[model samples]
Target: MIDISQLNYSSADFWQQLTHLLAWEGVSDAAVTETVRNILADVKKRGDAAVVEYSCRFDRLNVSTMAELEIPLNRAQAALNNIPVVQRQALEQAAERVRRYHEHQKQDSWQYTEADGTVLGQQVTPLDRAGLYVPGGKAAYPSSVLMNALPAKVAGVKELIMVVPTPDGEVNELVLAAAAIAGVDRIFAVGGAQAVAALAYGTETIPQVDKIVGPGNIFVATAKGMVFGTVGIDMIAGPSEILVICDGKTDPDWIAMDLFSQAEHDEDAQSILVSPDADFLRRVSESIEKLLPTMERQEIITTSLNSRGALIQVADLDEAIEVANFIAAEHLELSVDDPAEMAKKIRHAGAIFMGRYTPEALGDYCAGPNHVLPTSRTARFSSPLGVYDFQKRSSLIQVSAEGAQPLGKIASVLARGESLTAHARSAEYRLKS
Candidate 1:
């Protein structure tokens, strides 16, 4: 009885309907924007005092000073030591895999000397410090700690600071353990726009970070957007999305659960299945109905599917790919005999999970790929968070005196053409008369 939308490719208004379904405006309302602005301004002005005040007001913490809000590294270590053996092992394994995967993304500095003795190259360097935001309290996301922190650590960031909100003094042991495993240097019990402001502008206690990465609620996202130029930030992600292009050969139950995986994230999360076989789509719909009651997050799954999920009937696999490219989903699954072949045609997607056995959940945890991906059709332009996000490149150029002559003449002409007399004269000075 799930009221998921069903779309037919042959329908005259199909494209329009699809477009409407994909549209999601993630802009923060004026009220939220203004509130974030005020919070940022206050934190910038008052430093630790404003942060402490906001934490007491918003997080309901009984604290008088910034010292009370800081969580020590030994606490994270203790949490790691005390967690269940199996859970600890799982965390270690996941961390190792994530570390190994990001190591491949580590960039190195390179240089070369030209025939004219002009040295030109690129130097790669990691950020001095980074800030990570984790959702805490009732929600525990250890996987997020691994995905965001490991990449920065791998990129050789000198310090990694983590801020998690612990409402009413509630903290998740697993999150603390994950922070220990990920090597986060400092931990602060703060959240919302206030925490973001502290990271962007620097409180007396919290050091300003070169870049801020991780996920949060509407307020945090709004704050990140507002302070983007002040400090680098990851993309403003929208709700999670998964698009499955099936060949009607995979088990309907597996495919159904795959779609449910993203839907369970929240009511706004989108899940769509595209296939040529009408019978397979029907079977998957039935599977969704049957499986709904068994899930602990059944209500959330149901609401998500009913509101934004879809089961689309396409003319063939080719049409399905066309729809996928148009949607530019965050997670794309090609559940077919030849997923590799089909993946070649995919021009846009945050991450592609190939074959029937592969699911989006695997990528979210231990698949060795980053789960921090672009969402809300941003996959077309942006990419997932990786070691590269924590690193920067600088162009290296050292012109030899002899090499400067020809280059100086070229620069002089271009500068003069652009009516930049100072630039032209500066370049002319290096030229032989």
Candidate 2:
């Protein structure tokens, strides 16, 4: 049951209430960190032996050697072929859309020559290799496979390695099919912190990667954070979240169902709605009650909504937009009379869904936008994972004698001001020569 209040609440009060409802303060226990640190240290110390041991202990699989870890190419292909035609078609379509979107993001190496004979530009290059971590325990998300690998493939990464846990010693055929569609170079049957470690520090089997992307559990997230400096990581993702701004025009059942979509993801997942209409709020509340019992994941959804879901009654749509901005939700759905018009006012969402037809689930699967988005309040400063994550940009500068005189003088002055005599001399010598 959602509490509805229309009184003029201050920003601080609103924030406090939202925080309480959403459980903004995450689990702060050090057990996850301590465990990950110990695992990382073990991997660093014992190498493959440590990983193999952890694989058996945590993943409950008997993977003793590198050969056992490598998923055979033929096997992956067979898995792809075995999948249903409709599912394969869906995965292929999603892959194409993701590739097309990322292809537009690809940057070319460029050079520019000034009138003074100075050449300056930028060089964009892809990393040598990338690792994608796909979660396997709770559910299989081939969508995550496309979201993570397509960008790296479009960026022209030389090698793409994927690691996923398979407790039963069998990987999901759909995941393999999706990987094949996305041009994954290798698939390793490993997961969790050990899988991350195997990617971070090359094992006898898994190759070291330049960058790591994808979503995972808390253990995986901790491992990624631990090995960040050693290898490039997308971001330490938090729980899933969705915020809807409704003007009370749409059916409350639709709104209630949409909010539950995210809530069912995890107990910490946040779902919120900001509406001005009292009737709409009451209807949505009733809708949630009626709908909660019908879901297969009803228990999970109920726990999540009870702890993190909310329906706020704002003064108007403008106030709703303000509240949304302050929250900086990962997924923002504008279900207003004019969704496009309202979207212009939103500046801090990871992905904006406009109109009554565009649900957040569409973006999660096949809407051509990466579902690997910044979660929690990080949408304020971060962004959804994209092609840029797989590419690196280098500043290009070349100075001719004519261009060197002016630029070198400025550089020398700045270097001298910073008291770096060697830097000043380097610029001065370039100008003189």
Q: Please tell me which predicted candidate would have the highest lDDT against the true structure.
A: 1
lDDT of 1: 0.95
* Model 2 segments more than 4 A misplaced: 1-12
Candidate 1 lDDT at 193 equals 90
**For model 2, how does the per-residue alpha-carbon lDDT over 352-377 read when each residue is reduced to its tens digit?**
99988889999998889889998877
TM-score, one value per model: 0.99, 0.95
| 264: Cα error in model 1, Å | 0.7
Residue ranges of candidate 1 with Cα displaced over 4 Å: none
In candidate 2, list every pair of residues with a backbone clash: none
Worst 10 residues of 2 by lDDT: 1-10
